[model samples]
Target: MSERLNGIEAFVAAVEAGNFALAAQRLGLTRSAVGKSVARLEARLGTRLFHRTTRSQSLTEDGQAYYERCRRALAELDAADAALEAGRLTPSGRLRITMPEVLGRVLVAPLLLELGAQYPELSFDAAFNDRRVDLVEEGLDLAIRSGPLDDSTALAARPMGHQWMGMFASPAYLAARGRPASLEALLAQASAHRFVGYVRDSGRPPWQFRDAKGQAVAFTPSSQFDFGCNSLEIAAMAAMQGAGIARLPVWLVREALDQGRLVRVFEEPQAFGYAVHAVWPHARAMPLKTRVLIDLLVERLVPALAVR
Candidate 1:
């Protein structure tokens, strides 16, 4: 039975490839091996499959009939395999996800493209949300949120990665004001600096960092020359315009840092860090498609979201 299958495979490759030499390449066998396999098949079937020729090889009358049957059989086998795969885990249907606009653009967007390519039947409904929405009420499959999952009660939560907050300023601002040699120098140069504050109606955000001794230090930006809102995207842009220094997420400022548009103010480890959480509604059974996507996101996001 195994020999018959091998012979059939060689016969198929030869017919499709148009020559034994090409068939040998496709089958990962020597040209003589392919020829011998085809000859064995012909002997078993009591009919020659191909007309021997120096210039060209064409299928014989019996060969043409057998080729069609073999092609259909192989196609059916492929379809069977596909059916089993679909039954086991069908990565199809609408996968609605809610995430921050900035995170979506920076990290999730490229990964989503890769996911789409991997699962052809799958489609995505992405909402770049800044405000919290009722996931169950809104009919969302997943939500990627920053900070702690303290609000999580009815949702299954998984932390994507640790997101570090760093003091970032534009190159022009650093150049004009002179880069701070140390964290102390940065704090002491307060009069020479302005801040792009992140306001949440609670108040202006405190510029949080870790001291060299690993102590948490928080200081509110007193000199606010520009806008103060909850948007990291806006605050990052404000810093780039030389408005002031702002505490920005590494992922958000990575492009700017790489291009030297923005520079980290301190070498000390940032004290303020947040986790991006993947949350899904607690239910009887998670959908296979949803599980597949969540697994994929968690696997891809952890390393991609690293601060390096």
Candidate 2:
């Protein structure tokens, strides 16, 4: 109905502006008119779209889901309008993307900013977090993720490149305890030293690694310190302060190594690596803007961040 469309528009505007009054102003309607429209929408849908208080207006869980879908719909409408207005216009739409925090910030964010500059009509919604998200359920257009993706009938993944892991420690720590030349020496010396490690899902430390030759090798951490955490940045910082040795991505510690703040422990047959991929839903045909965004990421981010 006309009322429903009006409500959807008002609700979507409210989410984007973060307030009902702003949405009303944007729509050229009284604040009460916008509020009533949204209320009628909630009544028709049998779910609340936002939590309104004197100080703030925030989306509820159902509201967030509805907002995502509505936003996408509005974006598609805008894209269609622009295409009609400007013949042969490059892809122009809102792209909803997700990625891990570190990679998102250091790698993808810049590429998106550049893409926005190139495509004047394009906009984006990007979420950065380490936790895995259900892209289809959450209405995300794309996700950049590292490591093996679980098989999903509804999702598709495109492999981008490999990420190499390395062990690093600060110079102060090395001077005090001395660096080991080989895996055996490293293991022998590690038993007396503190180590920062990954936290497993079961609330235990991640499994240590070893080479094929089983030389008590470079992958295994010493039994001396058992401190564990889920964040690689945290582990790296701990190592920088001589808290312990840390296994982390080369991209993450490159600056530290260059500045002589951290030293690579093992060089050959680099241990603990994972493949990075761009994942999206298989059910939906990727919009032109989303496809262009993915291509831009592949062209710009892969070479910049991939391990040499």
Candidate 3:
């Protein structure tokens, strides 16, 4: 029975990838190995599955029918695996995840900690960075991402919540410089006031605002005191020191706003903020650990971000 299935994966991979070389790459095997495996499969069935040439290969009539049957067989096997996984009552495994640094530390970490405490069998390996990650390449189980997502068929995303950005300044700075009455006034006074800005490797991003019509507009303020740093925490710290007005995520400075260290300059948040998501590689049967974590985030993180 095992011998009957020996080259089935290689043959299907070649068909789907359009060439043995690409199939080899997908299967993590050498090109020669893939070719040999397909040859063995053909010998076992006493039929040619592909029309091979120096440059390319095409599926034979028999190969096309066999490929369809094999695909269904594989899917059934996957469903069987999923059935057993669903029956398990306890989640037990090491879940490796990556997320943006600031949100991961302040908003996501406590929920993960609570999960760990509830399930002794579950453990975590978490990495926090601001860069986008490839889950399959990095062997990560899941990721927490914010902002716009690129269209992808290779992964799945579940919305966690929205993170709103608000402009803020220290009370001392507000007292000394006076708060601008409107967005127009703020832009008019840009030259006179310092702005604590967040800088990315690509360059500084413009601060976002909503006009009266509720359309989004961007403003790039000039600041001699700009730290040119990527960390949002650093920008918030600078704003707390009376350095300049800063645009930051409301969740990040919740403590400072409550403590009176920072005062919100704008009465309202930006029109559209980053939409947070929990992303993971697509699978027929998701690992129990990954599914539970995603569910927890959906349950808890949304309300946490809603807190002003």
Candidate 4:
């Protein structure tokens, strides 16, 4: 039975490593030895754990179920070890996070480095992509999201702040075209101005602004241009280059506005506003490291993005 525990561990390592040779190397045992350990475990369980071919090896259905249980058990063991260590020292573990690339590069990277300096025991595994990911399935500690989050029973979210959408263009563009004095004037000059637009989910061409009173305002774009990007940072860049009026988050274009490279248009009617949030899985007992990271984000991010 004591040998059986070793066999179980070997079997799990083999399944996770996706190959017997790799698993053997990881476990610091010969390939033949790993095979024997797996065979012993399979014999005891009365089932084959893997389906192997010349090119590949994959877990059987039973093996997958068993692996899930074993993985959770191993995770719990590691968590207990960390918990004991945490009491004696600062939180120490790898915290995996995901966020948008532009925001991550512009904002998160510096903050995370500072955090690392503060807590030398903590480390980060951060990836930046615009695509939505399943936090639990992907084993993510946290994700930064910009917009309304769908209702999910499995996750909890903390609102960072709200972002207001506004239109901006380079000073050069405004000087060339002569800035429109009113919304109606802006709409009239739309045909001569290069207009940057977003492809909405509903297949509508681009977004039109409506006032708080719900009055639809149309800006007849001079020339319609679509770069087919979902990132506001990219669109704002186009606007800075004098491409045309771009509807983007005010937060993203603040630096340009301060430098006089870009000027806000349509100050009277605010377009759409979206909320930014930090989302994480709702676990029974959230890890101390994750809690600490989330707190740091909430404290730092809110002030950094405070409405000017």
TM-score against native, each model: 0.64, 0.64, 0.73, 0.64
Error of 3 at 61 (Å): 18
In candidate 2, which residue pairs get closer than 3 Å at backbone N, Cα or C atoms, i.e. clash?
none
Give the per-residue lDDT digits (tens) of candidate 4, residues 265-289: 6675545556778888754356777
Q: What is the lDDT of residue 233 in candidate 4?
A: 77
Q: What RMSD does each model have against the real structure?
A: 18.2, 14.9, 9.0, 13.7
Q: Model 4 lDDT vs. the true structure?
A: 0.74
Write candidate 3's Cα lDDT for 36-121 as tens digits: 87898899899999998898899899999999998888778778987898788988889999999989998788988999999999
Clashing pairs in 3: none
Q: Give the top-scoring candidate (lDDT).
A: 3
Candidate 2, 84-187: lDDT as tens digits: 65664588878899998877888889889999999989999999887789987898889998877764434556767867777788989878877777556766
Q: Which regions of candidate 1 deviate over 4 angstroms? A: 1-88, 181-184, 200-203, 212-215, 223-230, 269-271
- Model 4 TM: 0.64
Candidate 2 runs further than 4 Å off: 1-88, 200-228, 283-285
Model 1 error, position 31 (Å): 66
The alpha-carbon lDDT assigned to residue 88 of candidate 2 equals 44
Off by over 4 Å in 3: 1-78, 223-225
Q: What is the lDDT of residue 257 in candidate 3?
A: 96
Q: How many backbone clashes does candidate 1 have?
A: 0
